[model samples]
Target: MRWWQCRLAAAVALLAAVLALGAAGPRSPAPLRFAPGGRFKLALFADLHYGENAWTDWGPAQDDASDRVMAAVLDAENPDFVVYLGDLVTANNVPVANASLYWDRAISPARRRGVPWSTVFGNHDDMPFEWPPEWFSPAGVPPVHCPPAASAMPEPDPGCIFRGTPRVELMTAELDRACGLSRSSVGPRELWPGVSNYVLQVLSHEKPHDPALLMYFLDSGGGSYPEVVSCAQVTWFHSQSRFLNPDGRIPELVFWHVPSTAYVKVAPKATSEVRKPCVGSLNEEDVAPQVAEWGMMDALAHRPSVKAIFVGHNHGLDWCCPYEKLWLCFARHTGHGGYGDWPRGARIVEVAEKKHFSVNSWIRMENGSTHSHVTLSSARFS
Candidate 1:
């Protein structure tokens, strides 16, 4: 029964323990669990709002700062693409000049990275101006009956000529301005020729079994003014939505400049005064109807294919309330470039397996050089 038997039993026990640890070794750190095969990464930043008078002085510097931060981020993450959700410029009633500068600066970084970039229109980009009266004096009266040529129109009109009183003169002026005559020699002639709005289709590098994605970039006009959707653009959007075949799968991503729903309401600060619902003001009444008319709520409610909507009008970070299956996110503005007290920042979005996504917000430090990244997992929706 003996000493040899006892030693044999101890040896067996030791071998069993070693085997157990070996079996569990591969599982220790846990495999990267993603949503089935859906695994890809992308970066998103919205409401850069470049070119405000205050920040104009530092526009180039801020652009360089943002460019550096974004370059570092893109180099580190190596996302598939990048998206800017609008308000690229602070229109400031100078859409022609200011928007051009903003676009150049705001996009210079992404362009430098050699990455594909897309965007939607924000309210600020659509800043409007009134038309001079001579454009519309009724026929048979005189040469005045003919709409004033673009050269003759006044500058600094308070209202949007396109949708305000004196509709005829305004419409003509809009045509002239859009045709690249008013602010000639600046801005992209094609882009400035008409209201900028369009749909973009993004395909994945992976196979059909892999996660497929498409982004719909809508032009939500600007401010609170009502502008009819042009017949051509509407038809085009409808066609794009219907025809997109993402590896034979539906669109998995939808991006826009404005929230489909009113995600934020003013909980007035103690010192703030009540104000009327105006075209440019941010109030319940002004925002609510705009949200409705654009059919944003309805589109979001029914479009199961749309996994998310990213926007940036409010300039503050926000996540969807009630937590729907869809994810909604707001990116901080970079317009401060290097001027404002608010930290300039951008967002990084990671789309993982099973339709799961994560957002990490980055803020430009006070030094106006470095960016501090903050994980926004709290805002992550399944």
Candidate 2:
């Protein structure tokens, strides 16, 4: 072949390679931007508790009711994003596959609306029903379960239990396949093992990667395990927060399933004069822990940019209470599959992109009534 022909063929091959790379290039996760006028509204639907009972009519009926509640809120709010604050399914009572079915039902509303959403694991999320109920232990006592070696026994020993995949695996896989919405953009690695602990950045209008506001999702351990945010999880939060906001100029909001110890303190007086009745339950059993100061609450308190922390473990307790400089708020229980017969609703968080970052929140019931409106600003924080 002539030298010119050889050069021409090489050039064509290089061009083809470049085109292929461009076509199959990685799609960067789209950053959630502020809406016009710097306003972004997020709907938090907590404790959807899908698949409360797999083999019973009563459980399915409740799931349908919960579906109605989710549909109503999605239609009413039309939020930019939605966060499912854990307890997505009562996994312990149902098989792993059936539990995933419930996870699908719960996220359908958001998926249909084209709204981006994320989730943080609740205590009961991935718990195997095989684990004994008594293992959760009575008040103030940590759960005592069979040792890890017992899981290796081949025979059906009453004392031996089998744990296959981690609880978050199937649901995370289903979400990745079905809706492609609930998967975390943050970590599936050892740094945040066995849970969904990640961060989502709300970018500014001016810059692509420049974050205006941050959203942190942590896994507060639960189910066969005790309901506590481990020290390692707290360390992960601090590490991620520093990486995301080096100068601490950006504001943030944290989401998880279980409420903190400070929650009990502010919950009693949490009511809105402008909104309707705050009807719900707040028993001692619903609270997470005051037995030990885990430093998560204190860590948040020390961070000036952390505006508030939101949770949804107690299906009955829904209120926004002031704790330290930040607000510890409960998402109005929106599930019928769980223990409550109270009115179901979701919490709406609106963050403004003004000179100083500020926030306003309220509850929207299935009937479209708005309640518990509160505004948090630098002025209020101090």
Candidate 3:
């Protein structure tokens, strides 16, 4: 073959290869926008401390009533999905049989609805004491003593660290048993398995064009259970953010059992004898640090991808937007199904493709007799 013929053939082969490569290149994701007149809704209920003895006055009947109410509400709403924020059952000193029963009843409604549901660990659900700590207790360790009263503790215990008020002692003991931790001390491992605190990335089947939403469910076991999320969780979070290719976007939602931060009131000094606010009292401006150790607030504060944080435990209606751009919502508890002045309630949230959404909360009154609804709309985002 001639030299010119060989060179021409080589050039043609290279050109063909380049064209094929171009055709296989990745395509840009479509811009997410809410379908005009398209309504997407999901029901959210938390703190459904279901089980025997959960309520003071009623037992099985109350449980059944609560379950009925929840089922009825879901049927009425016909939402796309249901999310139980946590505290599915109250585990304090309760037998595993009771816990299982309550959980069965509580979840029955969602199951009957045949809708998908997901959960994050709440202080009550899956925390050590919900089950017998003996099963989880380390061999050769002596059981820790439960303090008698709040005054006996040397320091202020957040969430009743000592004396186990409102059954904290019993819960702590159970947690100790579950984690196979030495009763001599409770640490992080017994509470959060795998990494202490970690993020779960959920890709939306509905909105494939949007970035995968990351839900960072922190293990706020507090003094009751060992700190599960350690420095590693924080470090991994930072690293993950760096390489995240949400198609140039951030997570659309974040779900955790505890609030990123909370506000507490501090006392003013009276002429000289200054006293800090009483321990255990809610502070107006205090924010609970993430990981229970070290500072990750700065990392979360700077992450623009985080759209909103959903938390449960307060069992009341509250909203906080600490950062000008972020939204914090507290979901109401579903356990009030039996007792308590607080009505049993749940939230329904609608998310749009354009980063716009609306939240509506429903409360069951007269012991699941009727439901009252409240709706809140977010300032549109893109």
All models: lDDT?
0.46, 0.73, 0.48
Candidate 3 at 145: error in angstroms? 28
Q: What is the C-alpha RMSD of each candidate to the true structure, in Å?
A: 20.4, 7.8, 16.0
Give candidate 1's total backbone clashes: 4
The model with the greatest TM-score is 2
- Tell me the tens digit of each residue's lDDT in model 2 across 10-127: 9999999999989996455466898767888999989887766544577778888888998999899889899989888877655333355566677788888778888777766777
In each prediction, how many residue pairs overlap at the backbone (N, C-alpha, C within less than 3 A)? 4, 1, 27
User: After aligning candidate 2 to the native by TM-score, how far in Å is the CA of 137 from where it should be?
Assistant: 25
**Residue 233 displacement in candidate 3 (angstroms):** 2.9
Q: What TM value does model 2 have?
A: 0.79
What's the C-alpha lDDT at position 170 in model 1?
A: 27
Per-model TM-score, in order, reads 0.53, 0.79, 0.56
**Tens-digit per-residue lDDT, 254-329, candidate 3:** 5556554432112222123312211111112233333454444556646666555666666644333334344555
Which of the two candidates, 1 or 2, achieves a greater lDDT against the reference? Answer: 2
